[model samples]
Target chain A: MDTPLREPTYLILTALAREPMHGYAIIGEVAALSDGRLSLRPGTLYGALDRLTDAGLVELDREETVDGRLRRYYRLSPSGASILAAETERLRRNVEAATARLRARKAQALTPRTAGGLA
Target chain B: MNELERRYRRLLRAYPPDYRRERGDEIIGTYLDVAGPDRRWPSLAEAADLGRGGLRQRLRAAGATDLIPGVRLAGLLALTTAAFLAGFWVFAEQQLPPAEAGVPVFGPFVSVGIVAWCGWLIAALVVAVAPGRPARVAIGVALLMTAAVPAVSVLAGVPRPPLLVLAPMVALGVLALAVDDGLPVLARVLPVTAATVGGFLSYAMGVGAYWGAYRGGGGEFQPPIGTVLLLVVLLLAIGLGMRRDARGGWAAMALLTPVGLLNVHLLAGAVDGLASGAPRPTYPTMVGVALAVALLGPALLPAAVALRRRLGTPSAAAPCPTCGRHR
Candidate 1:
């Protein structure tokens, strides 16, 4: 892929990774998972779902109604799981690399110069 | 249904009929799921998002491009067209004295026209970036404002450009349906770029042809630039079509190849009329020339390319590609 998964796409797939969730549930779940960092509107969320479904990363799991509203549940497909895992690993590696560099810098800063007090 | 739900349903009709049929209820259900019972209307942000989304889907389904690319194409075309016009005026202002000039009338329109052109480019950017209903409307309005020059000129009996007329009309249609959505990037930009370049060059060269052919003032006037640009575009399109199965190539050809032919048609008629100091192509030969170019020119290139490709194929003797045999 020319680009990594966008934040919303990544989060949407993450929400479905746990279980099949309907539209409203996915919206709430994404918000909660992101600690309210991302709030997907209905239009934006649905458009993403369509794109994901078309790409075979997500698929409709079931349909139901609660309180007279149509609810179409979606789940991550096997391919989606594979993609999520790969993305997670990629993110983890990036995080680790940055953390390692920061730790090394901190240690270097704290270390006293052997030759002089302020070389 | 309550008033809000009914109103929302009306708004949802903006989506393509098939798309709305597929997911309209699901979308509406989502909207209501999130909305409070007391909420009477969708928020402006919500409406804009929905409008953009619907237009995006419609454009995606129709054009061979997605939303961003479509927007990019629109932004570029808008900017380019604006620049082309500005450059023309700059050239006119610099090269010729006010008392004697061969360019179109820019006298009264200089005030609003310049600002409108600037806003036109800005509106194009807005349409490209937002793709919302308001943005489209804004762009369309700006285009119409800039286009008022030609429109008024036509009403007051002055020569006007066809591109200025068609660009806004087509742009409005594109704004309504969207310019891009599901197609590839080139599928988005190629046809747009070709048409803009063709239009720009043709408009200039057509006027040039008119001036040179009839104005009793020509020691050395370069032949219409649009003619050469059209031939190059046509050949490039054919070459691409021959090499790869690309809708964009053919689409570009369809858009780009016509300008020079059109300019020829206009110039042919312009000469016959202007030489007599009458602004009508009344002669039969002039009418015939215009008719031939209008009828034959656009179709001729693609047909020729397709025919050449068909003939070049080694397996015409075999059964057809899809069916068992040719009819």
Candidate 2:
């Protein structure tokens, strides 16, 4: 089985799922997605991008010059999309399990207790 | 260029030149985009991250990712082996009877051996609790002390440890310095502790057997069952540990090389004694037979792993869809 995607890699793929985005845009999107809990520096982001590209999970979509500076856009490959979907399903199941357990505990707490047992 | 741009470029020099040429502009653009208008310098955390990233890229470029883990495991195993051997030597010497009247109890060679053994013991302790740099320094000092044993023995014209024993100890000391910084403290401590205990027990049994033979007027000493069992258990553990991946296989090979060499030496001695019509050197013969398992054992696992991987991979005869070349 494939290993689960790390949060940064997952968020980067999610950002590119909407449209191919440049490095800075993906960084901003990832930060916003995580509610500002993660702010990827240029080096870290490029490192992850390099690894993903080598793994055939990400590809260079285009390159452009903005205000005399180069910007390279990256997009998720088909394999990356399928892997991300599987990871999302795994996380959703975990969340559902936790939520169900917490709901049951809350319901039990709210019930009126008899002398020796739950009412 | 502005101050921030110049500094960021300087930091980018940490990367390989080819990588810098390819992605320098894009990386610099991202940094500039993230920087505020008033910012003049790169943050410390950013510099550290870039440095780490650059090192990772260099390692990847060198194809060292697979070997580094193996080398690290070799280091841990080597440290354990050295400590075990040193403990064995010290405990065995302690088992020797006191010198007769008007004779020195410990020879110069034995004294030097004890010092070297103590150095290895201290090094094992320091490596368990200390961080990388200090652990490396400790291993270095212990290696130097171990080398001094043969040197001092040769100069003083005293009986010294065989090269088969000293060479492995020295090699292990050097390998131990290759330990990775990321390994937990407990992982480093457990093996050394276990080996030290095993060493003491083996030597105690061997020396006890030697004394028993002398007392019974036996012509030759019998090899201790405990020591033979210890070696067997060590080889078994290494073999079992190697069933996982090529990394484990590589580690097993590194750790076993010394043991294999010693086995070869023992086998040669046994063969020579038989050829010369000497009373069959029972100890070397027995030990040689027991340790012979290590000689060709470690190589098999890695070879199998490689073969399996080769069989599972697609044939190179297939043409690449994009480039129209063999993949």
Candidate 3:
């Protein structure tokens, strides 16, 4: 993907990275992964899944019936995993740079001021 | 089905029937899994999301996967057409005989129209060079200036171009602003250059035709060869483009809509004149209707193609023989 992946897309991919999961399971995982900062509605989740599936970033893993209702499982593709890894690296580097800048600023602030001729 | 399931199903119906048939069960199942046992209705946010999703799916089903590309193409063609027409109109206005004495033909409205055309020309150049937000801003300004022509004319009681002519130019300007990013510089420049040359040729040919008629003692006027050649070239280009991509057809339609509108307006005027027993009774009602149908063809062709594609595809709408449920 040339453009940066959107937050929901990234979270969804991360949720699917561990194992193939059904729609509801992926939604729950995404919420947990985001620490409840984000919630995946069924419509929004399915829409992203459709786009990912079309882009070959995600694929149908299986379909089964539980409690007389159909459930379809989806898993991240190899391309999706590699993309996620690249995005993670990119974000990590950005965080490192920001952290270094903050550390330097703190060090500068904590430095002692030299006294003038009066001292 | 429970009340929640039933409501969710109702919301799911917003999708295209084929999509609903394939994904309805799965989508509803997901909603049911998420819903509490006692919950009876979908929350407002969920309903809104479902509605938006369904519309997006419908647009996808209609083969409008990404409208930006098509819109960009349309905008380029539309702006080119508007610039060419405006340039030609400005040139053609100069050919008219001067007004009698102090009674000016169009008064200050002509000057205003010229300024608007200049704005369009500048906007075209901006699109070729600057693009992005700059191009959009230029087009927006040009559109406003162009729209002001009729408004000023109406207020000042001066003759103005009919709304039929001015409307498409304004629409084209809006279309040009629909996307901020621009095409390649060559892509943007070539069309504008071609249109400028075409406009010049049209003006020269029109003047030559007028002079020829005047010199030949004026019987029936013949269509200018340049105009005929231009039309043929335009049709050929569109045909070749359509052979390559579907966007070409849409672009061609966008380019031709103004011409279509003008033709229809002219036809209506001729019909009215004939009914009122004017000197020339060339166009009949049948001819007008035929022209109207021809005008409608470009607009209808895509819808027809989309419908055919939808019906021709074997969808999951059919119920399974054994299970008696849609697959």
Candidate 4:
């Protein structure tokens, strides 16, 4: 259960958690979901897919021919879902920490006056 | 289908053989669907990039990050083989003379047999581990060294022990084959063996003459002195290279150990011959030795380091995965 959550792996796991999708579809969805922040180069995409598939966090749901081209659809396995939940919790904690730091900075900035009157 | 298939196959070449056999077609099929028929021929750069990608895939499949570690491992194995062979030869020689009442049966046989064994081993190792360019250089050096052994013996009035040089050359050939990464072991070994034999024959013929009948061209082949000198110098250069590198440990010694031994055989015979008042100062022998040391010493000396780096490095081609070999 060492979290194998590299950026691409995390993104892929997040995408597969939604519904089953083929390789290309997953590529498109990930790009769209990340608003172009994440692009799936073929090499990078396949590598991530292979790892996820191996870890049992993703499973090939079915095979299909769209426009007479073969593609296998992948869905989040139960393990995948659990891992995603853990990742989400981890991310949430990071956000909370950041928020607290920001609030403390704001409070310091808003103080009426400091001893040096630099507030 | 034709365009796609060709491109797919081309890309597939990057993957390791096992991976390609397992899923190359399937991966290509899926790619075709995604890109559709509209996808034009990949530009040269695109193809190159795809090839790199394919390499990465193969690397992942191989469960290894780089080939450097493998090369290091290969060098170690080679060193071990050299040590084992050298030790056995020495032990056999030491034990045989003492035990035998008259003629030492085991010592000569073992020595000769070992040289042949070493040649085959070095040849095999070179072909297996070394690429085309290095393979050629290695084999050439080996053949030259082989001839040098006998030439030195003849000039210095040592016993005509063919096996002394032959065994080490054979060992080196096998060593070469054992480390080959790409070429078939057979391909590397055959050329090396043939070249070694050719060199040996030429040396035997040249030195076997007493500078009387075969003086054709008045001077070109007059004494066969040049060839003899060349072999001696070559042997000396290789010997020096091996010794220098031997300081680096097994890899260095593996290459140097045979040459060192051959030098021993040559020097020992020379010393004995000189002590027994073999001959007066022959111009040819002096000239040959002088020219050999002159031509070979400087040229081979500089290259000694490079040869060591090529043969001595743990893995010369690939960087270490976790940290670069340099780091």
Fnat (0 to 1) per candidate: 0.59, 0.67, 0.67, 0.13
Residue lDDT tens for model 2, A1-119: 12677778889888888898999999999999999998998889988887787677787887899998899888888998888888889999999999999999999999987796655
Lowest summed lDDT window (length 10), candidate 3 chain B: B214-223
In model 3, residue pairs whose N, Cα or C atoms come closer than 3 Å (at least 3 residues apart or on different chains), thus clashing, are none
Give the winner by TM-score. Answer: 1
Ranking by DockQ: 1, 2, 3, 4
Off by over 4 Å in 1: A6-8, A29-40, A85-119, B14-22, B43-78, B81-85, B96-113, B116-145, B150-327
lDDT at B16 for candidate 3? 82
Q: Write the per-residue lDDT of candidate 4 for residues B13-66, one digit (tens) a residue.
A: 886665565455556765665566677665565465457667555544443322
Alpha-carbon DockQ of candidate 3: 0.29
The residue ranges of model 2 lying beyond 4 angstroms of the native Cα positions read A1-119, B1-65, B96-109, B152-160, B206-244, B270-327
Residue-level lDDT tens digits of model 2 in B11-60: 98888675677778888899999986799999998899779777655544
List per-prediction Cα lDDT, in the order shown: 0.56, 0.66, 0.66, 0.49
TM-score of chain B of each: 0.45, 0.56, 0.57, 0.26
Error of 3 at B108 (Å): 6.7
C-alpha displacement of A62 in model 3, angstroms? Answer: 9.6
- Lowest lDDT sum, 10 consecutive residues, model 1 chain B, at B214-223
Tens digit of per-residue lDDT, candidate 3, span A27-70: 99999999998899988888888878767788888789999888
Name the docking class for model 4.
Answer: incorrect
Q: What are the per-residue Cα lDDT tens digits for candidate 1 across A1-119?
A: 22478778999999999999988889999999999988898878887887787677887787787877788888898999999999989999999999999999999999977786565
Clashes of 2: 0
